[model samples]
Target: MKDKTVAIVGGSSGIGLGVAKQVVAAGGRVFIGGRDAQRLERALAQLGPAADGHSVDSADDASVAAFFAAAPAIDHLFTPGASYALGRFMELDEATARSPMDHKFWGQYRVVRHALPKLDAQGSVVLMAGALGARVGLTGAAYAACNCAIEGLGRALARELAPRRFNTVSPGTIDSELWRERPAALREAAFESFAQGAPLGRVGTVEEVVDAVLFLMGNRFMTGSTLYVDGGYVT
Candidate 1:
């Protein structure tokens, strides 16, 4: 992976940052994009000197296009962040629910569409969805719908990209900042609930999801596959 260029959209935090760190550890040069400059800088700092930072708004086509234009020939591309808004079906507002479709679903779509031309022949694209794509539980309709769409997109792109390799990583209940945003009591309760429900008896870690991404990026033979890092959540 030494000297290989990897471009990651939404790499400022969470799973994206995890993957960026792993890529750098594997001897790859990384360019990470996010809307927050400070967060991006901090991520780059943690990733060491081999990582570069860029400001990108995944919802904006112009921003995505320009970021990709400045990126070097990418050996691998990964998008681990996506917009999320949760609410019951009846409580879900049309605009709010569809917002994730624009950011998470279409955002990933745009990244691949624009980055494809810049990818090396053997390059791979690893997209992040979640267990909601295949499993049904407490998540709202928007999350489930968008994730399912992401999975379908990966399959189609895998066939279209052919030898280039396109795949999706579906994680379940990862302990990311998203969960940290909640109140301590609520967070603890949520974690405990997940621990009891998940077949693995624990939530996933950022490194676990990162390992799956690395596996997909390094393996040339795997494509059009939805690799579940969910720890039996779907079972």
Candidate 2:
């Protein structure tokens, strides 16, 4: 992976940052894109010299196109940004539910559409999904639909890309700020619920998800695969 260029959309935080760190550690150059300029700058600073930051709203086609245009031939592309809207199905508003799909679902699609020509033949694309794609329940209509769509997209891309490798990483409930934002009791209860359901008896870490992404990116032989890093949540 030495000197390889990696572009991560929605990489300013969470799983994306974890992957960026791994890429840099593996001697790869990483460009991270996010909507938050300050956060992107901060992440780039934290990632040190091997990382570059770009401000991009993945939901916007123009922004995504410009971002890919500025990025050099990339050896890997990952988008870990599909998170939005969590409520009971009955309570979900149209805007809340559809926003994630518009931003993350189509956002990832746009990235692939624009970046495919810029990828090396051996390059890989890792799309982020979650156990929700397969497990069902808990997450409301929005997340369920979005994750399932992501998995479907991964399958299609893998088939179309053929030797180029396209795969999906489905992580379980990970310990990230996204969860921490919830009320303390809710967060604790959620974690406990996940711990009980998973055969591994615990939630996942950012690093664990990152490891899966790295494996997918490096394993030239793997494609059209949906890897569950969910500790048996879907099982």
Off by over 4 Å in 2: none
Clashing pairs in 2: none
RMSD (Å) of each candidate, 1 decimal: 1.4, 1.5
Off by over 4 Å in 1: none
Instruction: Provide the lDDT at 145 for model 1.
Output: 85
* lDDT computed for candidate 2: 0.86
lDDT of 1 by residue, 1-235 (tens): 7788889998989988888888888788998999988988889889998888778988889998998888888999999756667777888789987877888999999988889888998899999888876875664678888888888998998898788999999988889987887788977886787677788999899899988998998898899888888778743
TM-score of each: 0.95, 0.94
Per-candidate local distance difference test: 0.86, 0.86
Candidate 1 has its poorest 10 consecutive residues by lDDT at: 132-141
